[model samples]
Target: WNVRKTSNKAIHGVYEGVTIFEAPAKIGLNQQAVGYVPTDEEWRFPNFGEDTAHGREFTQSREGTFGGDNGTKSVLPEHKVWFFYLQRICNHCTYPGCLAACPRKAIYKRQEDGIVLIDQSRCRGYKKCVEQCPYKKPMFRGTTRIS
Candidate 1:
């Protein structure tokens, strides 16, 4: 279901008994360098049964067409292709590496929800947080020189 169609202000949804929440918008931030970061404009919903090039490659790898007797000549049937969609986001761990890596103490976790956030003003564009975060959630904005 498209949440924007229902309400632009809404940021949460339920799909197949799983609750999904939208990531906060990063206005004026060029997030191309960041790995798989979600924006308010784009929601990373699981697209099941989508026939993508990566899906085709995954199917071939699973069927052993690349290294087995088939070599590279075998093509798996379209109906036999099996792929699952995974939506990645910050796990908000009890011990956040991003928060711990910030020398300026720019990154902090909220006491209530435990949401990790980087204080932009205090951040000196030191990419320690970016390097330490396993999920690669905190991104460095080169234009602003802050992470």
Candidate 2:
């Protein structure tokens, strides 16, 4: 709801590895439910397998939001289940991984707020900081190889 009010960015859920808020699901015996999410009324199944579950799986990349380079799809079990949403944010660690991984000394940790930041002027765009970040918060722009 906050996402809707703030930037109005489309909020998508990571289901079966893909970034999607709704997907095809099986509801009850021989009944098909289209575009299912945890918030949906049909998501709650009185009985397990007979009521609700996804019929097929659509695999997505670990960087699901960006759809990265590693997206894939596969089959998954069909059964009623409850999905839990887990949110991950930048930890702003005392010893920041991004700050430590920048070979060009481009990333820094602010003393006041302890927020990790990148110095774009010095950034060679090696994406070492992107790789080192556990939450995968750092983003690389322009090109991958760095001109």
Quantify all predictions' global Cα lDDT against the true fold.
0.54, 0.47
Off by over 4 Å in 1: 1-89
Q: Candidates' TM-scores?
A: 0.40, 0.37
In model 1, the Cα lDDT at residue 81 comes to 21
Inter-residue clash pairs, candidate 1? none
> Total backbone clashes of model 2?
0
Best by TM-score: 1
lDDT of 1 by residue, 77-147 (tens): 44322222222367787667666566787988887788877788899977777677777667555446676
lDDT of 1 at 100: 58
Of the candidates shown, which would achieve the greatest lDDT relative to the real structure?
A: 1
Model 2 error, position 71 (Å): 19
